[model samples]
Target: MKAAAIFGPGDVRVMDIEKPEPGPGELLVEVKACGLCSSELGMWVDPNFKTDDPIFFGHEVSGNVVAAGAGVSKFAVGDRVTIFTDRGGYAEFVTVPEDWAIKLADHVPYDWALGEPIGCAMNGTSRSGIEVGDTVVLIGIGFMGGLIQQGARLKGASRIIAVDTRPESFELAQKLGADHVIDAREGNAIQRILELTGGEGADVVIEATGKQGALDMATEAVRIRGRLVIFGYHQGGKRTIDVQAWNWKGLDVINAHERDPQAYLKGIRTGMKLLEAGQLDIAPLLSHYFELKDINHAFLLAKSKPDGFLKAVITF
Candidate 1:
């Protein structure tokens, strides 16, 4: 089997590795598409984050089951599914625990069936406590933020304000049901959000950029007693928060990232259900594709994030 491993910063090479077999209660999947996640960018771009040993890093995987191990009765050899794996997904073959696999509808596209991040979006929006007629403000309209916007709309938010620095993100944000899109580069994002909400600020504010600037704006964008959802994967350093404001506002702050495997499994199942029911559309979000051999190029493009780059998928 062929797989990708990072030798160092900006160096990901495809090399031959022995194909993995399904262990007890596992399923061996022939990889079809694996997503390039933003969380892995640290290892790909920064030398300080590199490790002594590098294993396969891609984890958002969707493919066909080629072999089923003992005690794996939930899936068969030919079932099309998306799986959750600790690692080793950037390969021709990878094994998945039976409980971590979710069946995908035949209509779902392989490239768009990225279960992990979609599951993260589901968990994030669910944790936001969005209700009907609530005003929701989303900071950072990237891939995770965009998915959260759609989920917020589906959850019956009356008004959705999308904020981002990139001009290219505005169109797609509106297309995904944002009532208003604010360019953070203008230095008036908080003011615009306040004006739109009649000075009360939003009922729910989600910070998905993982940058300190976005986090500061999110703290100010929510209503006095509103919910503040942190959905971003903040990496590389420490973050400071306004403890005094949080104390005064009585905000219900939620760190929306899930750690438990069962929680992720539940979210993944819900996301897949939404996709199958046509309530969620991920096709527009999967904007780039590359083969396994070009994984380095894919990582560079993902890091630089050129125009129209929502997400990158490595296809077999």
Candidate 2:
């Protein structure tokens, strides 16, 4: 088997590695597709964040089960599945616990089945307690941001405003069901959001950029008593926040990550059902595809963010 290992910053290599066998209550899956995530970029550039261990990267993955270990009864050999490996998904084969292996229905395409980010967005959005008829604003139109926009729409947001610096991303957000799109590079993004929400701040503001500026803006863009959900991965760091403003507005801050098993399961079931029913369309979000051999190119493209590049998948 071949796998890509990240030893440290600016260090990644493809090498022959032994295929892992399923352990108790685990399933051995032959990976079919995996999407590159933006968080990997941080891991590549930061030395302190670097890992000495040869970590097999990738979490959003879809594949087929080749074998199951003892105590695995929900699935059998040859069952198509998607997994949130958390790590070790960038390999030809990944051994994952049965609990994380989600069996895909026959109708879902393997390409779209690898949409674990959707589950992440779902978990975060649910945590925000976005109610129908609320005005929602999402800052950032990356993969998670796009999914957040769609999820907000599905949750019955009366007005969905998507904020991003890229024009292409703003347009993509509109296509993804955002009622309004704002280019944050322009001046007065917060003012524009307020105007869109008719003078009142948004009922819910989701910060998906993980940038310090975006975090500050999220806090400023929400209405009094509104909720602010930080959905993106912010590599452990400290950021200054206006505690007085947060206290004055009585705002609720929620930090979301894909850690809860029950939430992951519920999100997968809901997202899969939406995809199967054609209520949610992610085809436009997939910008490029690459073979596993061209994994390096895939990483480069993800880093470049070239025109029309939203999500890139390495397929087997």
Candidate 3:
């Protein structure tokens, strides 16, 4: 089978490799689609990210079960499923534990079945403790932030404020149910939110942009004693935070990334419910697609994020 492997920064190549088999309580899935995250962009370029040459990557996946190992009973060979953490989703085939694959809804398309991120967003929403009349501020209107906006709106957030530098993001955020949009590049994002919230700041502030500056802005934008949710993938590198402000404000800071499989599965189910119930629509977010052979190009596009590039995915 042919699989795309990352040799190093900006050097990805497709190679003919032996397909992996399912071990006990695992399933061999023929991947149909996979989504790329921003973290991969850093991995593709940053030399400090030590790894074996041509590392197996791409965790966001949706596929059909081709083979099941011993002790696998919940799924069969023909089940159409979206994988949570099945390894090497960039390839044509990936082997994951039986519990990692969730059966997809009949109406869900294969491409849109990349549900791990969605589940993570759902988990963020749940951990956020967003109330019916809460004023929510989400900094960085990317894919995860947009979905969180939808989730906040669905939860009856009185005001959903979106902040992004891109003009297109404002339009998309409004369409996704944000009540207010702030151009981060225009001026002080913290000031605008403070003004919008009448100097009290928001009830819940989420930093979905992993950038340190954005995180600083979120800390300033959150109200005293309000919850601040960190929903972005801050994979590596250490950064400083304003410990004095945190101590003074009495802010409830929460790291909303879900590491447990059971937590992810629960969020996946909730995300599926939102999709089925019409509360969350991901059609607009999937802005680019590429074939397996064009995997390197896809990564480039995702990294550069040219105009109108909301997200990209690889299709089998």
Candidate 4:
């Protein structure tokens, strides 16, 4: 079997490894597509964050079940499935806990079945407290950012403001239902967001960039007493927040990352429902594809995020 591993910083290699068998209460999946996550960038390049063990880092994945271990009756062989696991997804095969594998409908595309990432964004949107007619601002319109914008709109936000440094994402943001797309390159994102909201800032501001600058901008762009959802995977470092500003505004800060199994399972189910209903479109958001053998290059492309590169999937 072949799999990708990060032996150390700046090193991603496709190498032969033993095929894993499903343990009791698990399933052995033949991976079809695995989505590259932004968090992998820091884990792949930063020495401080490097791990001593070889890391197979992809988490957003979809595949077909080849076999199910004892006690796994919820899914059967040949079922199309997506999984969220600790590791082992960037490979030709992976072992998923039966509970972690969400069976997909026959019509679900392998790439669109990348429900783990969608579930993540759904968790953040749920935390954002966006209401009908509420003004919502999303910072950093990357893949997750873009999807969350659509989620906000679906949740009935009247005004959706999308922010990002990449001009390439503006059009997609608008297409995703952002009424206003602010180019952060202009250096007055906060002021402009304030202006767009008639000086009150947004009712809900989601910090999705994972950058310190975007976090600071989100703090300033959120209205007093409004909910501030932190959705970014803030790489590997310390980011100081403006405690004074937050105190003055009396903001409701929510760190929105779901780790519990039940939470993840519930979110994944909801994400699948939204995708089936055409409420959340994963098509426009998937902009690049690569093969498993080119996993290293794929990681580079994901890190660079060249124009039109919102998300990259390693297709098996």
Candidate 5:
């Protein structure tokens, strides 16, 4: 078996390694596809972030089950599955608890089956308490942000506003069901959102940029008594927020991370159902694909953000 291991910043190498066997109640999956997330880039660039011994850098994974350990009953050998977790996926094989391995439907494509980020976005959006007929503002139009926009539309948001510095991202957001797109770099985003919402700030504001400025903007763009959901993984140190603004508006802040596995499972089921019903199309979101041997090239392409680069996948 071959796996990409991270030792330190700018130090990732693919090396032959012993295949992992399933422990009790675990299953071994022969990975077919894995998606590179932004958090993985942060971990790759930051020297302070520590990983598990012999770190394998991936979470969104889809594959087929080759073997199952004792006490596993829900699935059998040769079943197609997806594994969602914090790490240990950028390899030919990954061993996980049976509970974390979700069986995929026959109609689901192997590449698209690795749609774990959609589930995360769903969980975060649901927790933000988006209401029907409410004006919603989503900052950032990356992978997670795009999915959040789709989820907000599905939730019946009256107006969906998307903010991003990149013109391509804003365009993609519109295609993903955003009613309005704002180029934050071009002008005052907060004022534009307020103007569009009829002088009353957005009913729900979500910050998905993971940048300090975006966080501050979210705090300012939300309406009085509105909910603000922070779904981005902020790699930088402490961020400053205007205490006076939040205090005066009586706003509710919610910090969402991938913690609820059950919630994620439910979201995955919903996403699959939507895909099967042709109500949601994620195929357009996939930007690039690379073979397992070209892992370093894949990382470089993701960093470069070439045209049509939204989500990059490494296929087996």
Candidate 6:
């Protein structure tokens, strides 16, 4: 089996490795597609980042079950699924616990069935507590953010305001059901969100850029008692927040990242159901695709984020 092993920053090599077999209560999936997540970009670009082992990486995966280990009765050898595995997805095969794998409808393509990030978006939406007719502001309309925008609309948000620096993002956000868009480069995103919310801030503000500026804007663009959902994958270093302002505003701040495997599994199940029902479409967000041999190139493109790029997937 061929697999990608990162030796250091900017150094990814494809090497022949032994394919892993499923353990008890696990399913061995033949890799069909895996997404290149921004969260792992540090491993490819940050020179200071170090890893004890590099064999198991790339988590967003969708494939066909090739073998079912003992006690795995929920799925069979021929089942198609989007799996959650902390193993090497950038390979010919990977094994996941049966509980972490969700069925993929026949209609959903393998490349677009990026279960992990889709689950993340769904979990974030659930934590947002978006009530019907609530004004929702989403800062940073990237891949996950765009999905969240769609989820927000389905959650019955009265008005969806999208904030991003890219013009393409504004267009996509509108297409995804955002009622208004703000250019973050204009230096008045907070004010614009306030204006759109009728002098009061939005009912719920979500920061999805994973940047300090977007986080600051989200904090300021929420109403006194509104919920602020941090849905972004913040990396690199620590961030500073205005604690005094949060204390005074009586805001409900929620970090929307899920650590518990059960929570992630639940979100994946819900997201897959939504995808099967045609309630969510991720076709447009998959902007780039690469073969497993070109994993390094895929990482470079994801890190640089060339024009028209949203998300990159490595296909078997």
TM-scores of the candidates in the order shown: 0.98, 0.93, 0.94, 0.95, 0.93, 0.97
Residue 137's lDDT in candidate 3:
94
lDDT of 2 by residue, 158-205 (tens): 988888898778878978878888888887899998887777799999
How well is each residue in 1-316 modelled by candidate 3, as lDDT tens digits? 9788787877778889999989999999999999987778887877766556668788889899999999998999999988877467889999989888888877888887777888988889889999999999998887888888888878779999999998768888988878889999988888889999999999999999888988898889999999988887775688689989988999999999877889998998888777867678898788899998898899888888899888899999
Clashes of each: 0, 0, 0, 0, 0, 0
State, as a TM-score between 0 and 1, how close model 6 is to the true structure.
0.97
Please give me the total number of clashing residue pairs in predicted model 5.
0
lDDT of 1 by residue, 177-229 (tens): 78899999899999999999999899999999998998899999999999999
lDDT of prediction 5: 0.83
**lDDT (CA) per prediction:** 0.90, 0.83, 0.86, 0.87, 0.83, 0.90
Model 5: weakest 10-residue lDDT segment is 45-54
Per-residue lDDT of 18-101 in model 5, one digit per residue for the tens? 999998999999999999887778766776866556677788898999999999999899999877765478899989888887
Q: Which candidate has the top score in TM-score?
A: 1
Candidate 1 off by > 4 Å: 50-52
In model 4, state the lDDT of residue 3. 90
Residue ranges of candidate 5 with Cα displaced over 4 Å: 47-53, 260-263
TM-score of 4: 0.95
lDDT of 2 at 193: 87
For model 6, the superposed segments whose C-alpha errors exceed 4 Å read 50-53
> Lowest lDDT 10-mer window, candidate 2?
44-53
Residue 166's lDDT in candidate 6? 87
